[model samples]
Structure formats: C-alpha cells, structure tokens
Target: MADLESGEGKTPVIDIPEAVGVFDTFEDLQQAFYDLRMIGIHHSDISLLANEKVLKEKLGKAYWRASDLEDDPRAPRAHFVSEEATGELEGAIAGGFFFVGSYIAMAAMLTPASTLAASIAAIAIGGSPSAVIGILLARRVGKHHKDYYTNQIEHGGILLWVRLRDKEREEMAVKIMEGHSGRDVHVHSWSK
Candidate 1:
C-alpha cells in the first residue's frame, strides 16, 4: 500500500490495497522496455511498463499520439517514418519469436496436424503437393535459419538500423542479414 501517513517520530501507515513495485522511475522503466525490445523480446515489456500508472499516463500520451499520427495519411511523412522505425524494432523482436517458435514446433513435429492442415488447405485450393511439401519443409528449415538470424542480430546485426517502408521490409532485412550481410539485423533509430 502507498504510504498514507508519516511524520517526525511516527511510522507510515496504509489501509490501501498493495502496490506492485517494478521500476521506480519512468526513465529506468523505458530503458528496461527498450532493452527487452533490443534483445528480441518484442511483445514482452510494454504491459510491464504500462503497469506503472503514472509513467503510463505520461508516456502513453506520446505512444498513442504517435500511433494516431501513423494512421493519418495526411500527416507528415516523418510520422510514418517513425512508424517504420517502430516496426523495425517490433520485427526484430517478433521475428525472433516467430523464427524460433515456428522452428521448434516444426522440428519437434509438435503439430503434425499442421501438415494435415496444409494438405487440406492445399487440396481445397488445388495447390500442388510440391507446394504443400515445400511449405512444411520451409517451416522446418526456417526454425534453424531464424535461430541463427536471431543470434546474429543479438551479436551485432547493425544494418537493421536502415529505415524501411514497412514491417515486412524490416522482416526482409532479417533475411538479408542472415543470407547476405554476415551480421545480425540492425535497425537503430537516430534517437538510439
């Protein structure tokens, strides 16, 4: 509970509901959130930071405003540029999860049902067996490929700093980093 009463010789007292202590300051909190994002934990930190009601109230305005600007076609292209930067950040993180999780599942055959699903989708859509097989095989191969890519990014994929038009472009950058650059994906904004 928050300290409700305290003075000279008296101790603080509280009858309020308990509080969850996380970060003690907004700067520290944002730094932690950014650190997680930088390290491929994309979707993990926002809620934890948002739990700080005061900090959220302050930064939430900026976050929401930025998002709103992204939605406005007539807004300055710089706003959209910021969106791309944000997307690159997200892609780096989520790409890590996607590549790792999908690979693990495929490698373990955790969902032979996915093969069945692919077959059904292929059949219903009149896709060739080769196409379905390729899709499944890609899933299997993509796991190891992505794990390597994520490791590279974690180590020092610095070019991911280049701005792209959208999230897909950022994802493509991950592919490029692994295949061609011999480095981790890097997408640091100028602000970084």
Candidate 2:
C-alpha cells in the first residue's frame, strides 16, 4: 500500500482506471450513493471517502492501507474482460443478431404459414438467441466491473468512486456527481 496522503488535506493520486466524484459533505456523498443506486448500480460497488486525516482516524484498521514496498499478494484481482473487449463483444453480438435474425426470418417465410404468423414466429424465435447472448454479456460485464472495483478498494482507502459497467452508466454517474457539485470528477483506467 502506497502512502495515501501526498500532503495534509489532499487526496492521494490513483493509478488505475476509475471514475471519481468528490463531495463536500457526508450528506452529499449519501445523496450521490442514492442517485447511483437509483440508476441501477448497487451500493456494494461504490466507495465513500473523506479527507485523509478523517479517513485514517475514523476508519483506522478498517481501512485498506497498502505499502509502497511490494505488491500485496492478498490484493484482489480483476478477472473480467477489459472495457475495450466488451465493446468488441457488443459489436459481435449485434452482427450475430442481425445475421441470425435475417436467416430465421427468411427461412420462416418459406413455410406454409400466414404472413403475420410467420413474422411473429420469426420475432419470437429470434429473441431467444438475443436473450441468451444478452444474459451472458451482462454476467461477464457485471462481474468484471464488480471485481475491478473491489480490487481498487483493497488497494487504497475509500475514495468516493463508482465502477462503470457501460458507457451509458458512466455518463449517468458523471452527471449525478456533477449535479451534486462533486469536484475532481475524473475517469481513470486501471491495469493489472
């Protein structure tokens, strides 16, 4: 664990990719947490922070303190694919849906069924594949985000941040923080 304090009353710099939001009061911090939860992110994935002294004194042994000497083998690891990989995955999913849906719809057209029935059947069958793909994607993305956030927490003290699972969620998190007058709102990338 590196020293979390650069100077008195200042927050330490983080090296990993992360989204950070700073609040003036604990109330504001709680509100940000509430808003994030309302937007579908859970409380477990968020971290709250105060100044260095406050955090060190209040959290005491409860806080995660890292040494600058060597990597902590006990530190949590992020196992999910990177955000860039997820983007590529989403593209592949879209292409697959397009190709598979078109083929299924065309094949259904050849059957001796009414136009409406064939269209409905095609849509219903096509949705199955989409649902399956969507589920797998969501699970992997969610796990990755959660694990990365956990790793961040274990590496340093709580810093009032959120782990973004997608672009829309990232945007919404920034908006919510800025809307609440959060300062130093930054997005950083973490590498393992």
Candidate 3:
C-alpha cells in the first residue's frame, strides 16, 4: 500500500507489485520515464538495469542476456547519473590527460642543456598523442554513459522497473512502456 493513509500506517510493506519491461531504444526508455512521472510515479520507484561493468563484476564474465536478470530481485540496479555528471567526468578525463602530458614534457626538458625551442618541441611531441588519446578515451566514456540505454538494448534489452501502487498505475505503466516499444511489459506480484 502507498504511504498515503496516516492512520493505517501499520500495514507492513511485505511485498510490492512492480511493473517490468524491456525497451529496445533509448528514445522509448526516455519517453516511458517521462510518462511515468506524468502519471505520478515517484522517481524512487523507478530503476534501470545495471551497466555492463557491474553485471560483469557481480555475475562474472559469462555471457548473459538482460532478460535473465529482469525478474530476479537480487539483480543489481543502476543508480541514475544525470547528463551533467557525465559531462564533468568527460572533462576531467581530458584535462587529466593534458596535465600529465605537460608535466612529463616539463620533467624531461627542465634542464640547462635544453633550449627553449627543444622544450617546446618536446611538449608538442608528448602532448599531441596524449591529447589524441584523451579525446578517444573521452568519447568512449560518453558512449558508455550517454548511450547506455541503446547499448543495453544491443546487448539484450534495456530493463526498466516501476513499483506500482495499485492496479490503475500498473496498467498505466504497462501501457506507457508498451506504447514506447517495450516488450514483455507486465507486473510482478512482488518487488525488491
């Protein structure tokens, strides 16, 4: 039951019904999330499937479909990270690379024997590759975070879970999910 009724608050939260689904695309996942919010679903009640790394760490390197984890309450869930956090991470990665490159170049050139032109040349030589590598790595990070939903779809499907307060919200959630191209949209009798 919802935490709405103040007097009957003694009702135990033993089992909670949850709507689950698999989204095939990022747009569908996003639209579903928005629609859920419009329907008064609290953000706390929504969760996404864990990322590839977490899955790997927990389940080992064995190949597994996302479907396998959908109904399992023990399956790990990913905490949502906003676009701002991802952007900051990308900036840090790139900046760290540049800093390391400059430091190493200075370490090699800060000597009386090194001319200004030689020092500058060393910096360019060392820094150029580092900058390129940084860009590539940063791009990789963006792909892992920004495109997470679609990437999960490629692996199997992007799993979404919405805790349902009642039959009405359950129906609404399933409808919104399916309308956005979700498959196997249904409500489990209990949730984690």
Q: Which candidate is the best by lDDT?
A: 3
Candidate 2 per-residue lDDT over residues 49-136, each given as its tens digit = 3333443464344445433211321223222233555667766766666567667776777778649877778867775676576657
- Name the weakest run of 10 consecutive residues (lDDT summed) in model 2: 66-75
Error of 3 at 174 (Å): 0.9
Q: What TM-score against the true fold does each predicted structure earn?
A: 0.18, 0.37, 0.63
Model 3: CA > 4 A from native: 1-14, 81-141
Residues 1-192 of candidate 1: C-alpha lDDT, one tens digit per residue: 223222223333223211111222323333433443463533311232111233245334332232222112122211111223444554555455555555554544544556766655544443344345545555555454435334323422211222333455455434543444222234422111
Residue 84, candidate 1: alpha-carbon lDDT: 37
Q: Lowest summed-lDDT stretch of 10 residues in model 3?
A: 2-11
Clashes of each: 9, 7, 0
Identify the superior model by TM-score, candidate 1 or candidate 3.
3
Compared with the true structure, what per-residue lDDT tens digits does model 3 show for residues 1-192?
Answer: 322222324323327899899888777787888899999998889988887778788667457677887876656687555466678888888888988888888987988889989999989987878878887898899898866766687778889999898999999999999999998888877765
Model 2 lDDT, full chain set: 0.56
Native-to-model Cα distance after best TM-score fit, residue 71 in candidate 2, in Å: 17
lDDT of each: 0.34, 0.56, 0.79
